[model samples]
Target: MSETARPAGRVDTNMAHPARRYNYWLGGKDNFAADRASGDQVAAVFPTVRRAARENRAFLQRAVGFLAREAGIRQFLDIGTGLPTVDNTHDVAQRIAPQSRIVYVDNDPLVMAHARALLTSSAEGASVYIERDLRDPGSILEAPELHATLDLRQPVGLTLLAILHFVRDFEDPYGVVARLVDAMPSGSYVVMSHGTYDGVPAETVTKLEEANAASGGLSRPRSRTEFTRFLDGLELVEPGVVPIGDWRPSPGTRPPEPADICMYGAVARIP
Candidate 1:
């Protein structure tokens, strides 16, 4: 497959984007000074921010592997795909099923740039990147590459990992998810991880909120109950929504404490 063309958007290094800041948290060199500054500001308040990022990323990898290996899913639609990192959706899924097809969507042009260069597919699989906002699910679903690569009539694993919080309340994050889920077939699955203030003390939550505001203030952490609402009407997998590290933890790995992780993760079927 040919590399995707550079997406049509200006790379604003002066402003910190969630994708770049997340890259900084993951200790990647793709971020700018502003992203590192914003990441530092959040880390100053929430000391375990990097841990949360790592655990969230691990959850995504595990969930993708489960979808491909256990759930019998051969296609994936990963929205809010940040900077290409280790064990991305395609990497995990294709390892289990080389024929798996994946469509990655993100608003960050820098992410799309890296994806075009780094996210290659195996000879038996396909990986396509589309620069589209999560808020606009329609555009992503309607992208020509998506239709060309995936068959919506078949079961697809829709992974929305650590992205919904960036869609503010006014943006109708639930609506965005509903639109995407509604488009999938009955056997499709939705895998998600979201930031939360569930177990944190009131003071710590206040401090974290302040630190986020001090930065770009692009994210809105939702409560566990609120996050669970994204899976309403769907059949949740075993153990339901729990701290990101607690969801089907890999053997021999010590799961992080719920208090430190501060993120909820779950996988559910569309039926």
Candidate 2:
């Protein structure tokens, strides 16, 4: 693909796309029949799948809020940003710090069509969308759109949610993460959520894996060891790597033990 030949404009609704399928699970309207069918198939096999998706979104909102309000982070680079849902990273961050600048990167065609929804930002902050592949970290970092929106000199929150799993061992997911983190300044944060089989029943994991395979989208359920490897050099926040619902959940809403959700969430600060 050429520098300008982004995978935007046309959306393939005939097949299930990761972002759109995720949107379907999140109860969003941007998905097509194929996405709904695939998502329903997975949800049927794993009844808690929808719950896990919502919990992950809640975690995203809370995490971004903390990064903006407490950590004083003013910029964000959200990779593999799925379909624009309620309270997107920019929304949560800019709500706390209006001047916060956010740049969202995703290669999904539906996400690209819905980029407009992601681009809306408060007057106090700035937002932009870039349709790019995270596998090419060099291109992602060097993209003019990214460079123009984010200040590399400042601490940035790099978000990779439900993404890295698509990149198998051959793709060197760890190295891809390292490339992005290495490019950021100290005090920066690496916030991530990964799907795993460590908590759920083997049958559920197998079913979801089969559905993802049939959809033609890459999906891999990593071990806790593999997930922690992504945060290799950073200082993990309190409570360490835990299930999404268990990551510093707010009052009144008690978190279920890690077994309830197959997704793991953790935030790490670059020292």
Candidate 3:
């Protein structure tokens, strides 16, 4: 196992980390009472929060499959990878192409606690975990684990699933993404899903913000314009930038009635 796969410090169950809180919402057992409480509060106001999360996860699965099986992408750099849920990026990609490589990144310590098995790789492929902050995309791009696992000269599927909100106003989220994309080769793909305020009531947005603030303290949710700005120079895949459920849902996968599909998703190829 790579040194980055080990848990850093002891897990802190006292504070509600976003990754664990999200896991709690998805009905996973990796979260604490604090996370459950926070998650419950968020769900109370916006009942579709859970559905949105699930849809986002489904989008990830489909996107990774498309990358590995269709786009022939063999390496994945999955940033903001929350808890180890079923059908993780590596699992989906490697299942299709056993030689696929994946590197999961997140700053949350709880994810690190579960990082052991996540770092396991197929004999034909490789997997690694890195506990790096998204704010410093340069650090993530420069990490030894990432450098060793991915080849910058080739196409890589960079999935920023449900994570851009954690980047506040001062963080230069666009520049952060731009830096990461700029370092990769042209054929690389950028998969993004961000929490947005589109179609949601103003007060509901306010309440959700307040709830998030109670724990993580005010994660800035972006607008459609802001979210699209991330793909400024890239070529967007069919269905353009739309709600998470709007992005190429497989047959039989019903779209959620647009209550709180308060998130937008898209896949764009780096030019």
Candidate 4:
């Protein structure tokens, strides 16, 4: 498939976006100075923010590898895909199974500018990007790009890592997740990671919340129980709902303490 055209829109370099800030945390040069400042502020309050970002990305690699190699899933629908990073969903999946197809969804204009990198697929596989928000599942499920690249009848690996926390409770995050999950076939998998204040100090939590508010983003860190609610009716994989660093860590990598990462991760299969 040809590369997707650069989307049209003026990037707001003044306001810090989660995708851009995350890119900064990951040591990427795709972020603006505003993003760096906002990231620094958050990191000042939560010094482990950078570590959590890296560990979360590692979790994504493991989960995608499992879905493509062990579960035999050839199609992927990765929502809230941040700025293109190393070992993206398609990269990991296609390495295991060259025939894997992937659809990346994100509303960030900067991400859209770099969508071509995400669209680069293996000789036998395909990848596409959709400029859309997580709140509108209907638009995502019904997108022509999604239909052209993926078969809804087959199993799809749905990835939502470190993105749902931005969806506030008022937006009905559960309903959004359910709509997307319900659209997938029975054998489909849901790989997810969410921010949590479970073990963190109340003062730190408050400061992090303040940082998010200052950045003009809404983030609601949920508990383990609340996070598990998103996986309702699905069968969890082994080592269920553990910290991101503990979810099948790569060889020679030491899992960080739960308080260090402060993010929960799990992979579940639709029965």
Highest-scoring model, lDDT: 1
Q: List the residue pairs that clash in candidate 3.
A: 213-218
How accurate locally is residue 38 in candidate 1, as Cα lDDT from 0 to 100?
A: 89
Model 2, range 108-197, lDDT digits (tens) per residue? 866866876545898888888878888889889988888788889999999998888888788989999999999999999989999888
lDDT per model, in order? 0.92, 0.86, 0.86, 0.91
Q: Pick the candidate with the highest TM-score.
A: 1
lDDT of 3 by residue, 19-39 (tens): 998898788998898889888
User: Comparing candidate 1 with candidate 4, which one achieves the higher lDDT?
Assistant: 1
What is the number of residue pairs that collide in model 4?
A: 0
- lDDT string, candidate 1, 1-271, tens digits: 2245434588998989999999999999999998998899888878999999999999999888888989999999999999999999999999999999999999998899899999999899999988888898887887888999999999999999999999999999999999999999999999999999998999998988887887768789999899999999999998899998999999999999998989999999999
Better of 3 and 4 by lDDT: 4
Clashes of each: 0, 1, 1, 0
Cα lDDT tens digits, model 4, 1-271, are 2234323457889988889989999999999988999999889999989999999999999999999999999999999899988899999999999999999988797797697654589999998888878998887887889999999999999999999998999999999999999999999999999999999998998888888888886578899999999999999999899999889988998899999899999999998
